[model samples]
Target: MPTITLSEATFAKVKACAEPLVDDADSVIARVFDYYAMHHAMYFNGRLGIAKPNPIRLPIGSRELTHTRLLTATIDGRELHRPDWNSLTREMHELARKRLGSFEAVRKVTSANLRQGRFEENGYRYLPEVDFSIQGCDANNSAESSLRLAKAMSISLHLTFEWRERDDASHPGQAGMMGWDPTSRDAGLMADGSSRSWHDATKQAIERIARDRPRREFTLAELEALELGRVVKETGSKGATPEATLRRVCQELRDEGYLDFLDNDGTYRLR
Candidate 1:
């Protein structure tokens, strides 16, 4: 995703929007919730290193709710039954309580993720990219809007801050990423946007696309081709043969189909 500038008006409207729950939420958390609803896995690398991307983490009950809505036992070719929110929430809340009780310092809690970008204590990050919503609010940087939110909400929740999202949306009061982060290459990132770091945004994008359409494998070239809707014209002097690029793409990406692409013209999309 190219950088998008949230307009001052949009910020105002967002702030003016009512809180999602009766739970204690100042403007800061409220805005965070808004963005979270839009993008569970978000990008929020802060220049000060205080901010990081944190994906949402759901209470298992919440997952069951999700399972109810998205998962049809017969669809995945699995043999089993599904339940509803009422049944799942019954136990999910208890599980969340038990899990939180096991933690020591409540201060250790963080809502943002690390995989979306560089995380620091300055650098800790979060994962799963779904249980949370992480994005750069640059609140201090967004002095103008920050003031508006503060004034409207009648609180001092931010000194210029960023919004935090997590997958555990149903568990609104829960704090922090569940277990820090997964120890895997999925935690990597690319500053140039050229490399997908298994961050929250990419995770959400992949899920949304997969849910909405036929899931398949493709490369950047192919995805780009697919997104562009087939080629009408091709450019560039055609320097070095793309063979090297294609070779590397095949080697480095998942063989599952990261490099496969669909092209009509120059336009391409992941198949």
Candidate 2:
């Protein structure tokens, strides 16, 4: 029922941060802040911008030519401000140095070497170049971890309704709120209106539906057939379409790993 607006620059930054993980808006905002912190730390600390005219000596190791080459390789020919360039190069150098001793040693380290060395290390090894995958039971365990995270956040349906006494001359419109938490099968109601009894009854009905019908799979048509569908329609919230709301909620659930799409179809299965 609420609308959010942002400036073009803010919207662009959010989108850029969300790339390859666009399903979660909260995650996108978090990542945008993280990116800003890493790239703009120096600027915030009184540097004019990301680039500086002078290059400072980095503790990358003994070989000067190899250190320069490594820094250049990490930058990959990007037109970064000098400070940003320096920071990125330093990070890469430290990462490499954790495993390799000197610049020359790090220069000899390649993706192939990383892949080969991954299994050789123990206790949370950091192999930057390795792409690791677990098959069979390990993947099932990973899925369970995702499920745990989703459950920790809990799942709920939030409904807000506005009410006014049509026959009472002195009454002002009041807002009411109701929410159903599927995890606990609990429904809560808060009202600031003369129609408190009606809102309370509505909340009870939502609780009954949530407790009794407990569904693992969801579809727009299925959701529209429920009591929630009627409630949303009766509320007359701006731009609140039953089908769109159902689709958006389903997408959010899927992104949080509480649900998974089945064969890229319109239906979703609880994860």
Candidate 3:
């Protein structure tokens, strides 16, 4: 079991915060990631064996570690390029744009290892397998905010960590972090004050996601591939000429209740 010890002052503050929420005294204040690791908050889709991967990157400085040591020290110790964190962050940013999308900035939220100015370095970044998805948890603070970001961003959001807000809610690992009761179901989406499938009213939302895509168009093959691949590609690139006939065709088919593979043909087509 992994445990973290905090300063007495921080502990006291977190304890005070947890009092109104639970029946027992909370010992560990966790982050979104921590709560997830401890199995406090859970997501349903993981049981289905669906996983998406994400990279964890943090910034560190030269003082904390020498450039030579970082560059050469493998988990076992070996020769490599610059060991400083700034270089690592730059590399990770490139990876994110290439794999996820161009707009998923890797700089602002990155971390660094600074050792009293011995060297100015940033954090390290690497890709890991992730299930579900990522979304920029925006203005709201409840668990509902997480789902909203997932839908609106049209991307998978790792619900492990989110921005902390005293006004709305605390960060996932805060002293009084909210947990999902076993009986709670995923909050259904709404529009016009009615519950609907995620596919409902997603055209505009999907379009917004496409705005961030680097490609100007997707081919017929690409469209089906994305769908089957559990990706969220859509047909709304800015000023796409002729609206890329293939994408339009796919959207039309999808909109008309045609989203299954034909048993006989082994291909997706209109119902």
Candidate 4:
């Protein structure tokens, strides 16, 4: 490995960016550069560092995500970390007890009726506040359960996962790429635009259109006419006229390299 020495001042700054026990030297450097590149509209070539690309922002209950190795969750602005899904479940219960008031209320929302199996088989974990099972689940089921529990308790949970897609098997040794999943459903929780944002809805609509439609290049008028219903269904807030909003989102997507605005005439070609 090549060695690059840092001065004492630089080393201290790097250490400050570290996530205590979770991040090592390589990851610390990778994170700093990734943040810089994202804001400056630059790209960081993979050969320069061990870190993989930065994580994407995903919606919770995304059916497509199978598993994640590490997760950071922000519950109503309070952040917490857990190593795995089971730990996340336990942490959610603890937070719900503190924030959701009565014990019965928590239990009513989280309990799985215990008639079918023994405690060990079910992987049941008992707390004074609630009793819930956390074992014998695949990643998809676990993620779904977490979403269900959060919604039932009216808890606003924003989750970020360090994970790699199945196709990334080509680079088996690479560190996990990150993705954020905001699962909060409460109307009051819409304050941060996580739950209700025109931009988020528009982004989702574009992705859906890209995946479902065969055509790569779409005129602005066609997209506005075709996807207005989808965007409206995804989010309740739409601030501007449909044409203006779609135009702004398409321009943003073009700037982000997901599409190209050819000839400046409002036709978008997927990139």
What is the lDDT, from 0 to 100, of the residue 156 in candidate 1? 28
lDDT of each: 0.27, 0.36, 0.29, 0.51
Candidates 3 and 4, the one with greater lDDT? 4
Write model 3 residue lDDT over 55-95, tens digit each, in one string.
11111100111111111111112222432222222333333
Candidate 2 residue spans exceeding 4 A from truth: 1-216, 263-265
Find the candidate with the highest TM-score and give its number: 4
**What's the lDDT for residue 112 in model 3?**
21
Give each model a TM-score: 0.16, 0.25, 0.19, 0.40
lDDT of 1 by residue, 137-183 (tens): 22111222222222222222211112223353332322222111222
Runs of candidate 1 exceeding 4 Å displacement: 1-188, 192-211, 215-219, 225-271
- Which is the winner by TM-score between candidate 1 and candidate 2? 2
* Comparing 1 and 2 on lDDT, the stronger one: 2
lDDT, candidate 4, equals 0.51
Instruction: Report clashes for each candidate as comma-separated counts.
Output: 45, 3, 32, 1
Candidate 3 global CA lDDT score:
0.29
CA error at residue 191 for candidate 3, angstroms: 6.3
